[model samples]
Target: MEDFLQNLLNGIAAGSIYALIALGYTMVYGVLKLINFAHGDIFMIGSFVGFYAGRYMARHATGEAASLGSAALVLLLAMLVCGIVGYLNERIAYRPLRNAPRIASLITAIGVSFLLEYGGQMVFGPDPKFFPTLVEKKIIHLGTITTTNYQFIVLAVAIVFMGLLQYIIYGTKFGRALRAVSFNFETASLMGIPTDRIISMTFVLGSMLAAVAGILYGLSYPKIDPLMGIMPGLKAFVAAVLGGIGNVPGAVVGGLLIGIIESFVGGSQFSSYRDGIAFVILIVILLFRPSGLFGRYEPEKV
Candidate 1:
């Protein structure tokens, strides 16, 4: 029982990270009806950026004085850089294929993913680097369960960001435009909604979330690798699909569920295939409920 509880906590901690990334997936899908497969690699890039930035700061800053408030600053810097990268990815790779077949965009997304993974290796080197542990404080403790400061911070940040996102989606003008664009781009354009801009913004927002997830991932594992985004990205996508591809809340639910399932499988079953569990669930969900948990069945208007 104790072990199960401990594992559950760990799963939630990990799931929070997945949920953050999954938001990016759901957002892009909801608006554009296109899966930004490269979003995960963008997450990877964010981790790398933060890892190097921390290392650089550590080397240059004086002893105690230098370390003062550096962690928060590093996180800010990482988020900014990663957000820019994500925005550019949307502008460069996806923008051109907006009117093309969905398959074309999907292929472009895969191409973009490869570009980032390989480009990262060439620039940062293929060797995996260590991300410096910025938030070293550990807080919150139970009988045998404990949460780290970084975990709390990451989870809080994810929740706050998602809350803000929900507000934007359901409350603000931009949100209305976004929803309009999602339901029907042509009508949105006819209504002078600036569909192109909304789509770009959606991609940018999703990318930014992915970047945050990357940083959180680095904090949790403290390792930097070009390929790190692959598994997490894939899993987050599975989560998005599992919860219903275009539903915002579904992404969160799906990510957390995937995280919990992976944790259990890894803890009790073969750890080697922990990553595979997400795909299995994805397949099962698609086989049974193609619309996903929160997805509504939309009949084609033939």
Candidate 2:
């Protein structure tokens, strides 16, 4: 029982990161109907950004405030850099292909992913770097289960971001414009909505979420690498699909579910299969319930 609880806590922490990254996938799909495969790379970039920012701040500080405050400031810095990268992605690689076939955009996304991956190697070097400690680590004991404050920190920050996103999606003019653009670009344009800008803004919002995930993951694991985004990116995609590709709340549920299941599986003797479980879930979800657990079936008219 204690073991189960421990694994659950670990899973939730991991799932929160997955959910943050998955939001990027689902949101871009919601508006542009294009998957930004390079988003994972953006998350990777954010980690490196946080790595440097955290270290710089750490060096400048003298005491306790260095830990928490430094983390917060570093998070903002990473998000800002990643948000710019997301905007550039939309402006450069994707904007020209807006009127092109979906396949063209899809191929371009893959191209962008490759460019960032290899480009990251060129810029950040092809080696893994230790994520500098921004927060002092302490064990948090929950009865018989053991964890750390980082778990709670991850969950708390993720919730705050999700809440802000909910407000943005449902409580603002941009949200309405985004919804309109997603519903019908031509009609939204006819109604004076700047569809292009809305689409680009969507990418920025999603990418910032990825940045948050990247920083949180680095804090937990204390390792940053150029190619680190690949597997987590794929699994987060699976979570997005499992929760309904374009459904906002569904992405959160799917991420937690994937994380919980993967955690339980890893705790068992099937630890060797931890990485494969996500794909298996993907296959099962696709085969039986492509509409996703939270998604309603919408018939596409041909």
Candidate 3:
């Protein structure tokens, strides 16, 4: 029972990171029906950006204000940079391919993915860098179970971001425009909803979410590399699929579930297979319900 409780607590924080990355997958799919494979690279970029930003602050500032400023500024800077990258990705690489066959866009996304990954290694260095602590670390215990303050921070930040996302999707005009574009690109364009801009914004928003996830993951693990986003990004994709590819809430559920499963497996003797478990879930979910947990299938008409 103690072990189970401990795993559950750890899982939630791990799941929060997965959920943030998964949101990017679901949102991009919702808008363009294109899987932005470069998203993982964006996650990589965010961490690298945070690493440099933290170091720069360390050299220039001191005291309590520097501490507070570094945390906030690093996050905002990452978000802003990733957002612009996403925007340019859509505008330069994806926008022109909008009218092409789906395969073309998929290939282009793959090309972009490669560009970011290898390009990142060339620019950010090939070795892993230690992520600086943005906040002081402290351990917390519950009976025989143990956790850290960073876990709580990750969970809290995820909740706040997800809540903000919920409002953007349900309460704002931009959200409506996004939904409209998701429903039917042609119809939305005809209605003067600016489908192109909506698509760009979707990429921007999703990438920003990835940036937050990257920073949070760095805080928890503290070791980062250009390739760090690969597994988490893939797992998040599975999470999006598990929750139903185009459904927003489903992504969160899938991410949390995957995280819990990973935690349990990571703590067991079969830890070697921890990464493989996510793919197993992916295969099972696809075999049983391709639409995902919250998704409803609608047969396409010829």
Candidate 4:
């Protein structure tokens, strides 16, 4: 039972990160109907940004007194940088292909993914760097289960951001415009909405969420590399699909489910196959419900 509880806690922590990244996927898909494959690379860049920022803070701080504040600042900087990168990615690579065939945009996204990966290797080197410890490590005991402050921090930050997102989507004028554009671009444009600007804003918001996940991931694992986003990105993609690709709340549910499954599998003898579990779930979900768990089925008219 203790082991089960431990695994559950671990699952929630990892799931929170997956949820954050999955939100990025869902948001972009909701708005543009295009999968931004380069999003993972944006996440990688955010981690590197946090890496440098954290290191700089560590160097200048007198002691642990300023660690938490420094970590918050690093998160903000990383998000800002990634948001800009996402904006450029949309403008330079995706915008031109808006009217092109879907295949063209898909291929472009893949090309951009590769470009970022190789470019990152050249700039940051292929070697992995250890993430600076932003907060002192301390274990919290809850009955039979033990967890870390880092886990709590990850969960807290994720909840806060998700709440903010919910408010933005449901309560803001910009969000209404975003939804309008997503529903029908031509109609929205005719209604005086700036379709182009809304699309760019979507990318920026998604990228910022990815950036949050990246920083939280670094804090949890403390080791990062240029290609670090690949597996997590894929898994997060699966989570997005599992929950209903364009559904915001679905992404969160799917991420938690995937993380819990992975954690349970890892705790068992089938640990070696943990990585494959996500794909297996993806396959099962696709087979049973192509529209996804949370997605409503829409019939195509001939």
List per-prediction Cα lDDT, in the order shown.
0.84, 0.91, 0.91, 0.92
Task: State the lDDT of candidate 2 residue by residue for 22-69, as single tens digits.
Answer: 999999988887878898899999999999898888889868876788
Instruction: Give a tens-digit lDDT track for model 4, residues 1-302.
Output: 99999999999999989999999999998888888898888899999999999999999985676888888899999999999999999999999999998789889999999998999999999999999998899999999888999999999999999998988888999989988887788999998998999999999999999999999999999889999999889999999999999889999998888898999999999999999999999999889987788988866444
Candidate 1 vs candidate 2: the TM-score winner is 2
Taking all chains together, each candidate's TM-score versus the true structure is 0.93, 0.98, 0.97, 0.97
Off by over 4 Å in 3: 300-302
- lDDT for 21 (candidate 3): 94
State model 3's lDDT: 0.91
Question: In candidate 3, where is summed lDDT lowest over 10 consecutive residues?
Answer: 293-302
Our model 3 lands, by Cα RMSD against the true structure, at 1.2
lDDT of 2 at 47: 94
Kindly list the per-residue Cα lDDT of model 3 for residues 1-302, writing each as its tens digit: 99889989888999989999999999999988888888988988888889999888777878877787788899999999999998999999999998898889999988998898889889988899999878778899867988888999899999999999999999999999899989898999898897888888999999999999989998998999888988999999999999999899999999999999999999899989999999999999999999999998966555
Q: C-alpha displacement of 252 in model 4, angstroms? A: 0.9
Worst 10 residues of 1 by lDDT: 60-69
